[model samples]
Target: MAAKTDRSDININRSMPPGKIIPELVYDDLDQAVVWLCQAFGFKERLHFRNHRCQLVLGEASFIAKANPTLTESSNNNRLQPQPNQMDHSVLVRIEDVDQHFEQAVKSGASVISPPKDYPYGERQYSVEDIGGHIWTFSQSIADVDLSEWSGVLSDNPEDAF
Candidate 1:
């Protein structure tokens, strides 16, 4: 029998990974990508799915790393590719120390896109490109600034706000 979560009525499967939204990132080399991501970003491996995919977690956030299928395997199947010259999307992770995370990523040979910078919105963040070209932004909250202070509008209903 499936269990239920207090946060919501959704059924919780202990055998499956957790996270409201888990990004399944495609990489040319699954093993290398997993190692690099763990070493560079402090992600811990939560589950391994043979040689094709794996689940990784950083704090409360989790994402899947999948091997990009070959042309033969992609035939008549959904085609997934690694990030090309132009990125389709980027992953953002909130951590305790953006500076420490940035330094670790740099030491692990991650390509830096932007160094740590403080924003008026009360976050210190840094961006980097992984070995497979995926962009990841690490952020740390430095303050609890109101949304209006950063030109963000608050929802009329307090319940609508995250």
Candidate 2:
């Protein structure tokens, strides 16, 4: 078998392009969803769209919410309708301060879930359930720790054990 040869002079892509990551959450009402999203996650509305079908929708952070069920269904594959005892999904949004964001959401009519708490992953995060049953978790980076410390308590094994 021949070993693969590198074509370094060909200008091949050595570094990956930045990824565009934006998750869209669908709701039964676009207007209400927009309000809740802005309040819960602090997403800024960017644009809106409408057609002859009367589907009023708005876009924020690459996410679009529809005012009607038909449009919501078409926008997001993980469309939701609150069940009796089960949850369909949740959205985790990165923020500067989860405690402050949680308080803001509470003031904006969001139902509190777990209060902002520190996690092993260096995040102080909290949860809120919107009126439409969408779960939004706001998280903030807390501290930088070694992976071992992050996993739990630091190991006491001798450094020479390796």
Candidate 3:
């Protein structure tokens, strides 16, 4: 006879919400990265795991962080992510006030990539890099300007080509 296993302690309702995308990031020092993210960008720690991985939440947006994987490990594809401060991609977030957020980030010692500026498409935006060298773009909508007026694009009719 097969032995019966107890299965009373399980929670199936705990999982990420539907239609939510969570981006994963790698850091050299996850502790400092978490602290910097909270201080500079206002993300609260949602969960911490094994001293190497953590989850950060800001409103409905969230991202998971893990220590950078070793390059010598033998795994499928045998590849590793680019070192911190070397990646070219950036994370963009929408906020209420671009200028105030920019000031706070600057005060928290984040490296400024671009100062706040208004764009024709109705966005006041700025860019910065955190201590782990992750580029972040914070933007706020300032207007509802028509796209056609700025770039002469997005025609109303299909025959308006060229």
Candidate 4:
């Protein structure tokens, strides 16, 4: 493999370049989901697609939301039909302050899954479940620690260990 120094080698236009991965989520009620996400998670609405879809942004992160298709289609994907207060996957959002975000989220109607706590990995974070049953974790880095302190071995070859 060759080293990539800039977009010039990839032929990506600066104005229309690709961004970090944006997650796609499904909800039983997209309108309610949009409102709840904005109010609870502090996401800003970027675009509204009819009444069934929406684009939301928070800082450098963004995600797309669509109405659930469980009623329209007969598929047994449990993930598509998220039960109330339960979710298989969670979104981890890097925020400026975990304690403040936790309080704001609770005041905005987000159910607390976990309170703000510090971790050995050098992050202070908190978790909450949205009205749509999606888990959102807000994290803030509190310190820069050596990996060995946390049982992570440093190897010359990055892929040599897991």
Candidate 5:
């Protein structure tokens, strides 16, 4: 679930909505990644189906997770087909408990790139990688620092002394 939500006027029905992310990953074994994500990161399974070619699918989308292949602009295969992207960008997920979540992911075989750290923007977050090599950065807002008091923020007061 999204913790620090930006001010919004749109009325949403559900507690959460599907995340919008597009990433390409290389995986000969897709099923393994799906199962591990559900168990490790709490992403629920949404739907499973077959494409036009009748290939079995494991598309699971929820408020937290969306599993699908990312389309690439180029392909080197002799068949001249567009292949799913193997190298991709990291997806950052903001959560409530950075320490607990990071521990759980580590227990579930995720390699940690960095531990939780407090950022100036008021968040304590950590990062991990799934088996398929996709980086998932889970973050949480821990400190609510007043940027107005900082030396460089845009505000009437340039420093706390004011």
Candidate 6:
């Protein structure tokens, strides 16, 4: 089809949240989730909807923490639920220092899945499970490694790679 046009010049509604893609994580306890995420993950609370949802931000990134819907409150098609014991997905965040972030998360009682380790892809990263059982990965780029060096395939469209 056709290439997408840039929309940066267009004015966005002020009521809408920022970020091209914002993830909404469901939690059983909205208040506790907000507090734990702030303390452990260093996310600052941006906006809170009483007892329902809250927007969070770290640097220029943003996401939302929403309350899990009760069975009676939602239909199966639209119901939201907290993370189950088995992880189906994880959120990855780029930070300035992976080591420092891991330490702070550990100190704040995050359950460590993997400690910080450097990868051939030129990043230092770690994984942890939050209070709501959601997995989060924090990473820091340590070098600008060539994709070929790590056996990574480059996209034909260079703009799609980033």
Q: Least lDDT summed over 10 consecutive residues: which range in candidate 4?
A: 10-19
lDDT of 3 by residue, 6-87 (tens): 4333323333421145777767778888998998998888878766678888766778876665522332343344445676
- Against the unseen true structure, what C-alpha lDDT does each candidate score? 0.87, 0.60, 0.76, 0.78, 0.57, 0.85
2 versus 4: better TM-score goes to: 4
lDDT of 4 by residue, 73-138 (tens): 554555574676656788888989788778889998888989999999899999988887888889
Please give each candidate's TM-score: 0.91, 0.64, 0.74, 0.78, 0.57, 0.86
In order, how many clashes per candidate?
Answer: 0, 1, 0, 0, 1, 0
The best candidate by TM-score is: 1
> How well is each residue in 31-122 modelled by candidate 5, as lDDT tens digits?
66667776777665554333211111123233233233333224343322223344356777667688888787888988778888888778
lDDT per residue as tens, model 1, 35-127: 999999999999898777899999899999988766335345465675546788899999999999999999999999999999999999999
Residue-pair clashes, model 1: 0
Clash pairs of candidate 5? Answer: 26-86
| Superior candidate under TM-score, 2 versus 5 | 2
Better of 5 and 6 by lDDT: 6
What TM-score would candidate 2 get against the native?
0.64
- Cα RMSD of all models vs. native, in order, equals 2.0, 9.5, 8.8, 4.9, 9.3, 4.2
Q: Rank the candidates by TM-score, best first.
A: 1, 6, 4, 3, 2, 5
RMSD of 5: 9.3
Model 5 misses residue 108 by how many Å? 0.4
